[model samples]
Target chain A: MTTLALPTTEEEIWRYSRIDELDLGAYSPQRCATQVVGDPAILVKSSGSNVLKHDDVFTQTNRDNSEAIVIRVPKSHAGGAVEIIHHFDTSGALYCPRVIIEAAENSEVSVVERFVSADGVKALVIPVLEVHAAQAARVSYLAVNELGATTWMIAHQEAEGERDSNLNLSVVALGGDYARVRTECRLIGQGASAQQVALYFADGTQMHDFRTTQEHVAPRTHSDLLFKGAVAGKSKSVYTGLIKIHPHARGSEAYQTNRNLTLSEGAWAESVPNLDIETNEVKCSHASTVGPIDDDQRFYLESRGIEPATAERLVVLGFFNEVLERLPNKVLATELYDRVVAKLAASETVGSE
Target chain B: MSVLEIRNLRASVAGKEILTGMNLTVRSGEVHAIMGPNGAGKSTFSAVLMGKRGYEVTSGSVELDGVDLLAMPTWQRAVAGLHLVMQYPTEVPGVHVDELIEQAWRTRGRSTTELADAVVAEAERINFDARLVQRAVNVDLSGGEKKRNETMQLALLKPKFAILDELDSGLDVDALRDCARRVEDATNEDSLGAIVVTHYARLLEDLKPDFVHILVKGRIVESGGPELADRLEADGYAAFSG
Candidate 1:
């Protein structure tokens, strides 16, 4: 069994990441249960065995070791939440799952992938996913991390949209010891649009890292990305994204925004956004902010009779409302908000030792 | 009993003295109009009363119905029935106006369903656009609408003692009249004690304040009836501060 070398933090693509700390030799590959909690018939269709091109260690390792599940949505099947929960119970082992979702032409679908583990289960999970949105199809996928504190995950997602297609990708990162996800989105057809939104919160020495790319390959394509995270309890978060417009992709519009809130003085977050435009006819902009929650908003809420602790929680939840409102699944958004509020209550006291 | 009483109040911010030995008293079912010139510490007094940070109450005793108010946190003060219609309402981007009021009343043990009803009913009674309650708290609201929203909140919460710190500053004639009527109705219903802080006499005239005080240099230099505000409308704070 040949193993790929682990990425080091010195690598620019993995800069400020915990990749160097991962010891691939410590664990061996194992297959986790990928149960379709919903009707499998609606999601178990195949779009043929389309190969994904990627050399990343986690992606290759998953492809070689894990079973691949290709979920197919029939043409014009507009309403299906294809919810899949990956359960990993093996301790001191490596679990990997690969999911491939193909939305047929003019079909709308929502694929929810959640990673879960029991408490005290120590493992490393690597998942690779590919999403193909066909012409005029609409697809929304959400990945939620609910791993235990003893686990870690490094995942990658590659998504491409066809002509006039729409794709929305969202993430809620609230668990695991150290989790990193790289999302790459390509608008492969003219009039295609894609939105990438994520909400991540790290506490109690946990870490979350994200790398995203928005590639506009066709003219008149548009992409918008918003990622928000909060860190507390000496935890850390890193976000680096790129919006790339090809030379012939004229009249393309891309906007990227990343905002982070540091609830404790010890907590830290870093945001870096880049734009690579080869044509002057493109409209592209990126904005990034990493700071503590505004005292004005806090005081305003406090003055309105909300307890300080409760006020902080509400503000933190409200901070993510902009992104949550974009979710196609309202029930998932509300449940995710409750989970975030619980995470915030743990670190509500900003200065308390 | 005094609904609110500030005894020998002295406060400061950033090492600068603002409220120096100020004293005031209010009882339920009474409206006290406080007229002060610019730099007279009107806003600071409101901040201090609300327990807003950075305003150090150097030496003072604030009692809300005999409860030691200074010891409570800002939110607790509101829960204890002390409300302020801020001059400049803070803009909370993602919090809707209805959510703001509903959350505040929630702290007072009000059920969400009850408070939601109150928010809608009170907004209607104040003639506030029901659509405004759907918007973010004070974000992109017109000045008049903001004041009306605060008045709408005042009606919903129905605090025991309310402070209108220049609530009339940004309102037009009709907005001023509308807000005044809402405040008046809330006071009559709750038997609320209120302190109207302003630089102009228009709001006081609309509300028909029972007692008017000319506050100069952080101290109440004179206290009388509606006639006092009428006189100050003509004389200005220069008559008392000088």
Candidate 2:
């Protein structure tokens, strides 16, 4: 086995990241395990990740140290939210967990993988998830990151949807010192559709970074990506995404939008959206916006008797309402809304002084 | 005792003077019609009273119930019982009308569920379709529908003072009458003091305003009873021009 060097911010994919701050020598690899809570038949040993290939140093390291967990959803299973809760507690530890989800043809399934950590513990978690949606299948997957304040997470999610399948992917990031998720999705079959929605907020000295790619490889595919975030108290967030339509992917439709809100003077956000369309019959568009909330929107609510502070809180939460509504589960969305409100309330007290 | 007073109001926008020493007083349970031609600063007067930014008040005083309104922030003014029914009601995506009005009552510590029911009942009063309550605030609504939604808020909040700026511009005959009836109903139910700005007397007919002031060049050039509206309707704003 060859020793892989740590990555730096000089690479295009790692630009503007906190890669330099990461010290690989500080952590030793640990074997991770998973326990199935739902149908035992769904849990099986897999040889490797077919969808998520090792593309970066972190992924390669994860592959080198992690034990694999495979979830197999049979045809017509009609599953609910199957949860895989992974908690890290060891300090000065490096833990890698690999997961693969295969939704059989004509099946409908939803999975939620939540990552957590012991409070104030310094640790690193590198997780990789691969999802393969078979023909005519429907899959919904959510990754919720609620790590400890001193912990860091470097994760990758790769998915492929086959002929006429439907894929719904979501991410809700609210905690961590430095967290990053690189999502890559490909529509490899005709008439397939994918919807990606994410809501990430960072407070204190935390940083959240996201990179995504929506690739349409077949004709008449559709994809919509919306990622919204808020940063306060010297925190930062970055969003970079691409919408690519191949030459043979005629009559395809793709849209990518990334919106960020900077709540404090020290808070910062960067948004970059790109499109590469080789077919004239394809429809692709991308938009990115990063700034403070609009004054007019706030004033409009205030004039209607909403207190300025409450009005701002409403706008920030409301900014995520569209994406929240698009979530596969409304109950989960409501819970997330309340969490965001709590974060805003805490920030309110910070600003009052 | 309850009145909205604007005295010697001189204001400007972007260094160009608009309101030149305007003056008016709206008492509770009274409706005032402000008739003016284009460039007469009717909208500017509404904006200034609402404490909208971009309008510099050179010399003026706005008082609500003897409290100096100009001294408070825009939202504090709302909390103090002032509201504006903007001509072009702003659209706030992702904010539902029912939810926003619920938040309105929430700030006042009112029961939001009760206020929500009140919104639906108020919608019925204006013949507004209840389905629209679920839609985002003012988004994709017709001009007249937007006016009706505004009236619903007015009824719900029951502000001590309200200003309707060009709410009758894009309404049809029925819509105009409906808007007028809604305003009249709110005044009867809550004694809502109101300032209605318009360029036509058609809306004033249904309103039967207690007072009519012809504002030209940012000043009240003419003030009279309901008959003033008829007179202006017969002789256009030509007599008040310049």
Candidate 3:
């Protein structure tokens, strides 16, 4: 294997990000030979034994050498959820994993992937996932990142939708030293639709960054994006999204929203939503808000005999509930709700202590 | 015995005094309606009882069945049998109506099996579809449906003392009639006491309260039997406000 060098600030995507702070020289790539162990409920495994591929596009600019792990779902297969679990336990190292999902025509599937790191390990991980939805197909994907506090993570997700196909993607980030996620969806076929939802919570000294793009290249397509996040302690987060409608993509409807709740004065959040519509008869709107919890709303809950801490928890959960309710799967929605509530509870406990 | 007693209660929000030395007493097995004009501190009174934040209780002593109600948290008050049917109940999205009611029921120490049975029975009484049980609480529900949902919550919680704040405001005629009957049935079945706050007598026509008190400018201006509702309906709150 040849050593690949990481990119610097000169690259357009790497600009405005602190990519040079990461030292990948001492980190070595190792195959994930160890079998995964955890509660099956939270783990996601591939359907068949397939040779997985790993690539680092930032280090190796050669797209030819980049390998892609493909998981195909047949059109006749019944639609259900698939879970993918990635566990990293290495110390003082960098890890990169690439994944690809292909949904056949008229099929429907949901994939949930979890990224976790062992305790006491200091590592950097950059993961890239690609998804292709064939004509009239439907695909829903969720990524949950829960790494150790000493770990740094940067992930990218690119999806392409075909004629009359639907794609829904969600990301939940709860742990990391400095985590950044970039997700893009391209509607390449007429009548295709895409929905994107993201929920993130950062506390202590954590920093989370998110950037997304919804590109409409065909006519009569639709897209909706909602990204909500909360910050506490001395944490910081940033969200930047773009909705681009091409000249030929007339009659496209697109909406983007980013809302942030700051729980502590020391915490900070920044949101930027942009739209570029080149054609007539296109409807596009973007909204971004960053503020603390509404005092009146919190008071209303507390007055109902809910304690201050519990009231805050309920309000925060209610804030995210608007987005979570949009998820199609009730069971998965409940599970995600529980996980977010647990995060809030842990923070409340720590704040109180 | 006195289920709730409020003495010289004075509360404020954002440094503005709203509840000015108000006083009230509610006994078990009795229904008291607090009628007032808009901004007479009726809603503020309910907020104060729920221990809502931001409303500073400048001076007051609230006791519930010999226990200090003011000292307990809001949920604790619910556990202690204090329920409030808010005028505008918050839409708790992503939470199923059944799940929320069940959680509230279990929080009151009811067994899971009992809670489930109670929810089903209450839903049936309100003519609520079994399918609505799985839907998010109050989200995208019609005004009438939201009111029924509130009543459903009241039935499930079975609070010993409840305060309904203008529950009839957004209800239609049929919904009002149904809600009134449900209230009558709930009170009769559990011998529960309640403070029914409203501006009109239509809701009280069927559920004839044991007493009706006219609340004016944060004070009870007049207290009488069911006839008071009829009188207020004819005369209106104008004369009472003066």
Candidate 4:
């Protein structure tokens, strides 16, 4: 096996990241079974991830020593929903869990992946998920990160859409000391489309980072992204996204937006949005904003006899409602909404001061 | 009976004084109309009374039932039975009208279940579009719909004093009459006092007022019965300007 060096903050892709603080020596790879709850016939032990590239040290490491599983939906079949839960309980351990979802031609499927850890456990979790949508297929994937306060997670999610295929990707991150997700979605066929949404809240020294790319490589492809987050206490967050339309991808449309709310004096947020269009007939737009709760919105609610804290909570919830409506599954959307409310209630005292 | 007394109310915006010793007293079940020209401190007065930020009360006292109103925050003032129907009601996205009203009603120690029924009943009484309650508050609504939304809140919340600030600015003849009639019904049924701020006598025709006051240079320059509004309507504020 070849020894590869870990990535540092000096790399352009790792800019504004806390990668330099990671210590590879403190962790050793451990094996754990990922619980898959769904149609048993759909699960198959796969050799490795075929949809993702091993261009980075993390991906290579995961490929080197991970038990890969694939959930395959038969052609023209509708796989209602599947649940995959990963639980970490060992301290000072490294976990590399790989999952690949395959939707055959004209098939439809939905999956919910959750990562959780036992309280007070300190570990590093590197999770990789790949989605392959064939022609005229539809796929929806949702990821929920609920690791322990001391745990660290670096997740990679990649998806490819074929002709007339549709993909919906969503994430709700509310845990881990430092959680980062890198998402790359490519529309490689004509008339393909992708929609991405994320909601994250960080408090009590937590940090959440997101990097995304929406690449349109075929004619008449479309992609839209919306990521909203809030930082309270002494926590922080970062969101950087890019919309890239290839030269041959004429008649493509893409939009990227990232909005953040700084809820406390000590909390902070950073947002950067970029667009690269090499084609003439393509339409693209990118927008980002980092600020505090809108005073007018707060006043509007408070003036109606709602208390200050309750008003703040309501405004924050309202801010996330747009994203919530687009979530693919109704049951999980309701659960995530309640989690947001609980998170706001937990940080109310920190925010008020 | 409830009383809203504004005594020697002095306020400023960005260090520039707008209200110079303004005084007014409103009692329950009474309607007072304040007519003024543009930039005569009409909106500033409402902002100061509602404790909206950025309006500094340099020296003044607003008393509600002999209790200091300036000391409480805006929500507490709402709980103390003070409401303002804004000239341009703000649009709150992703927050439904019924959701906001229900939560606001519950905050005042009222039953949540009853609020839903009351909202439906109030919307019907005012001829308000019942469908709007399910949509975001004032989002994508026309100017007349916004005014009707505010009037619906006024009738349901039932505050002791309701300040109708430019309530007729964007209303048509029919919409103006509907909103004004709702306010009149509130005053008669709930004994709600009101301070109507407008530039013309059109709204006064639908909602009759017991007194009419001409505001100039931040103070009441003339006060009389409803005849003052009719006379001012025939003529302009040339005689009232200092």
Q: Who is ahead in lDDT, 1 or 3? A: 1
Residues A215-308, candidate 3: write the lDDT tens digits: 9999999999989999988888988888999999999999999999998888899887888889999999999999998776555444344456
- Clashes per candidate (backbone, < 3 Å): 0, 0, 10, 0
lDDT of 3 at A287: 94
Residue B209 error for model 3, in Å?
A: 2.2
Docking tier of model 3: it is: acceptable
- lDDT for model 1 comes to 0.86
Q: Per-residue lDDT tens digits of candidate 1, residues A224-338?
A: 9999998998899999999999987899999999999998888989998988889999889999999987788888888779887767766777788877887778999899888
Quick one: how many clashes does candidate 1 have?
Answer: 0
The residue-level lDDT of candidate 1 at A51 comes to 35
Q: What is candidate 4's CA lDDT for residue A139?
A: 95
Once fitted onto the true fold, the runs of candidate 2 whose alpha carbons sit more than 4 angstroms away are A1-4, A33-36, B109-113, B169-173, B230-238
Off by over 4 Å in 4: A1-3, A350-353
Compared with the true structure, what per-residue lDDT tens digits does model 3 show for residues B65-110? Answer: 8899888777788778788887887775445676566555555567
Task: Tell me the whole-model lDDT of each prediction, alpha carbons only.
Answer: 0.86, 0.86, 0.78, 0.89
lDDT of 2 by residue, B72-131 (tens): 878888879999988888887678888888888877778765766787788998878888
Could you arrange the candidates by lDDT from highest to lowest? Answer: 4, 2, 1, 3
- Ten-residue stretch with the least lDDT total in model 3 chain B: B99-108
